[model samples]
Target: MSSAQGGSGEREESRPKDVEAEPAEAAAETSAPVAQETSETPAAAPETPTEEPTPADEPGQAAVTEPPAAMEQAAAPEPAPASEDPAPPPRAQPPNPDGEAKPQRTFTPDFLTELFRNPLDPGYADAAARKAAGNGAVGVPKKILSGVSALTLVALGFLLVVAYQQTVADEPARTQARDTLIEQVQSRRENTTDLSARADQLRSEVARLREQQLGGAALAELQEAEAQTGLAPARGPGTRVTVGDGPSPIDPVTGERSTEGRVRDTDLQRATNALWAGGAEAVAINGQRLTATSTIRQAGEAILVDFRPVTSPYQIVAIGPDALQREFRDGVTGKFFRALNSQFGMSFDVARIGDVTVEAATEPNLRQASPSPQASVRPTSSPSEGGR
Candidate 1:
């Protein structure tokens, strides 16, 4: 009976051992399935150990035996060797204790940590150089790549500087070409106007000779025509008139005023009319004479007389008898000038241009009027030229 009771105690202890072994066997079976699931999931879900109890944590002899037995029933040993060969190298067992080797801890000094903290230090460089020496061909390509990148950047910068200089060198020639074009356009416009005026003057002279003396001697005929039609050359003593305006008015939006300002066309016309009534025979504006066909145009801040730009301080010269100049200086026209100065703050000056040449205003370019009376009788040609 005592042996029976001793056997019963042994059986009870074995039953608890068996219970622990069962869990270990179950864990071994489950681990393969769990690891497979971990591999299938995304890289974010790695095989980290959970906080729950595992058979591996129960480090007893009975628990240790369970995996070998479970694995033996599930798969053959030799078949697993190919997969286990790679896995065991990464997780090599540490040295055993109690007559087994104590683990030799290799003090690696956390080389990665040192590399991050002392990236630019010579000490780190020496270690990296040693590692690179061991790596051989792998490190040589990296050095060559860095050197090539630096050389490429330098070449690009030099090309940019050369291109910029070439562009700057071309600018002056372009500006000179633009100025030449503008000058040629202005010269052509002036020449065209002068030619038209000459043709008209020749036609007027021919008409006069035919009118007075149909068959008189040429010299006698010329004198007769000149006296009859007031065709004598225009010549007289003249007064000179200069006109200018007040300073520019304030700009309402910008609140700024211009310093160099001048008179308007209306103001200039008023002064010209005053001189005409004062018995002036011929009037000239900015060296251009007034004629029946003369046009005064304003462009921006300048006045254009026959396309010639004239600005502030305009000079107007007129030719007539000397009696007209003296009379105009103190006559009703003189009062008009004073009133304009007082009312609008305009400026004016009058002077006598002695022996001034007031050439006859070129005869206007006449579009053939009634084909001139001489059209049927006189010799026909392209067109006659004259100096007016």
Candidate 2:
């Protein structure tokens, strides 16, 4: 009862009825109403008599028919296309002149762009519509879901209660222990400070009493011991010797600065030993005085003189006769240091000082004496042995 204008505007006459639809086109038509008769024909076939659709059972009713699928498809409408015959798509337009694929023209924007533009997903709306219509996709029941959620909440609450109880149980003991430790630390610190002050007072008092009580020979002997043992500060003519790290040159092979020239603990130990060999009397290095018990040793990268660290450039002060500097230069110390200077780029300087003061050594050498063998009596031992 309806008519469609031809795409080329030709009369729908003088052509065989090209009534067969493409399988794909038939699928498209199934979802919609049957296509109306086109005013234009498909091809310029010779005119043929038309076979009309069968008439309806009711009188004066218009005949209704569906177009047949292509030769590859069944004559009757199919529930689904068979496996053997697949129909080609119907083309409404001619192919491009250049034979290249046509660029798809879309009115809608990209998916991400649309997602950002509209935050709500279309599927959510469709699901909500299905729910409103009381035909939602089957899943877990609401009652079961709600019961499970309640059980989960109850479990979480039980865990929280247990955790809080455990914390409460431990909190008091931990707090008490921390407070006790703090109090003990504060008390010990105060006690130590008080003891230090008391010790200083006692030391001063003892010194004053010793000066008042000790007379001529005793006083002189004490003074001599103090000077010899480096207990008292020294002031006399001596020599000043300064030794420093050598200059480091880059190595050609490694392309890095060589560490060979750097002053090591062993180097300082050797240098100090040389000074002792050169007859250094009451020597001090970097203000740390040296006694007979004093030691020069290596600790990691440091040089320790009597357990005290000495840094470069090392300053060695020797308190001795006016000839001390000259003797040091004439000794092996001078020749060895000169070799160091020539080979390793080490710096060494010596000067004779008319007056130099050296600080007293901080530590003392403890010694004990025993009675001579001649003084021991044999009478008591002999009596016990004779009786046995």
Candidate 3:
């Protein structure tokens, strides 16, 4: 019996690791009945109990339970969550005509995502990566080119420094020259004003002498001619018409201001003509007297009267009879201006303020035609000439 037990222990030792993991409790039957020690023929032999060995007693048994990581990997898969927004498909392009195949565009998650995040161009990023990786072997030609480029950049920097220094050095001289020119212009303007005042004084003296020398009829004729020629200032009760620019409404389709709403030279000319027709003795626009030969025309957006620009809110004052306003407002030209006011949102006002003064205009240069020697003779009215 001792030999059989020795063989059994040797067999158990030689078994595989899986068999060693089994608990020592397997030999006992769970349904075995407990013996009752009631003097029944010297109590039956007590049955041995079965108990499993702890993991400390059986080290090889721990290998049967898997690790947490292995358990997670081996777990049954669940359905994937639905994607809220799927990636867009690639953009399509037309087929190449030259048969050189164009690379198909692929969906890139970072194409737009990195634009604002990293605004550097792809070439710049590549250069940065290359620089970070350190430089490789450079050829002789490329090294020479790089040296020359560095030399050129240094030279340009030096040139800019020199230019800036030169400009700074010349600043005082330039300022002095500019000041001299300004002073010269101011002096010339003052001289011209003095000369003009002197000439006006001389002219008044000459006029006084001539008035003294001339008879009543001749003096009266000269004064009337001066008044009519716009060489002398006029003053009287007259109608005043002020015309201003419109609101300058823009065209909705073209997105430009409408020209019809703007005041033009033609409008001033027409108003002046209308006032003349209404028996205006003298007329002026915006304090500038209008002469017979004075021109009213456009220079770009400006309205020039005798080559002098006039701003908006043109005020036209005419010296004429009390019937002057009535004739002008009731005339055909009045209706035309009314149309402009109604259609273009322009401002038109007519008033007769008491005694407005009109300034004298520059004297006009005139060349009067003369009769020939033969044409100057008066023809004698005779019965013989009448019969012929």
The digit string of per-residue lDDT tens for model 3 on 1-388 reads: 3332222222122223333343333311210111111113211111100111121212222222112111111111111111211323323323433221111112223444434432323232222222223331234466786898899999999999999999999998999999999999999999999988887888889889999999699998998777767878888899998888888877899999877778889999999999999999889999889989899999989999888889889999999989888777778777777788999877887777679888888544556998766564556554456668
* Lowest lDDT 10-residue stretch of candidate 3: 42-51
Cα TM-score of candidate 2: 0.50
- Would you estimate the TM-scores of all the predictions? 0.38, 0.50, 0.50
Residue-level lDDT for 83 in candidate 2: 32
**Model 1: how far is 147 from its true place, Å?**
26
User: Cα lDDT of all candidates, in order?
Assistant: 0.50, 0.55, 0.59
Q: Which stretches of candidate 3 lie over 4 Å from their true place?
A: 1-169, 251-255, 362-388
Candidate that beats the other on lDDT, 1 or 2, i.e. the better one: 2
Candidate 3's TM-score reads: 0.50
The lDDT of model 3 is 0.59
Per-residue lDDT of 1-388 in model 2, one digit per residue for the tens? 0111110011111111132122333433342121122112211111110221122211111011111211101211211222323223333333433221211112222445433433433233223323433444448787887899999999999999999999999999999999999999999999988987886677659767887899789988887788767877778888898888887888899999876666676665665676667666678888989888888777876788888888888888888777778877777777877788888988888899888888778645558899766456766665556777
Candidate 3's displacement at residue 114, Å, is 32
Candidate 1: where are CA atoms >4 Å away? 1-235, 249-254, 258-261, 343-345, 359-364, 369-388
Q: Taking the candidates one at a time, how many backbone clashes does each contain?
A: 1, 0, 0
lDDT per residue for candidate 1 within 121-223, as digits (tens), equals: 3322222222322432344677886899899999999999989888888887898899889899989888887777766666667776665556558756674
* Candidate structures ordered by lDDT, highest first: 3, 2, 1
Please name the candidate that would achieve the greatest lDDT relative to the true structure: 3
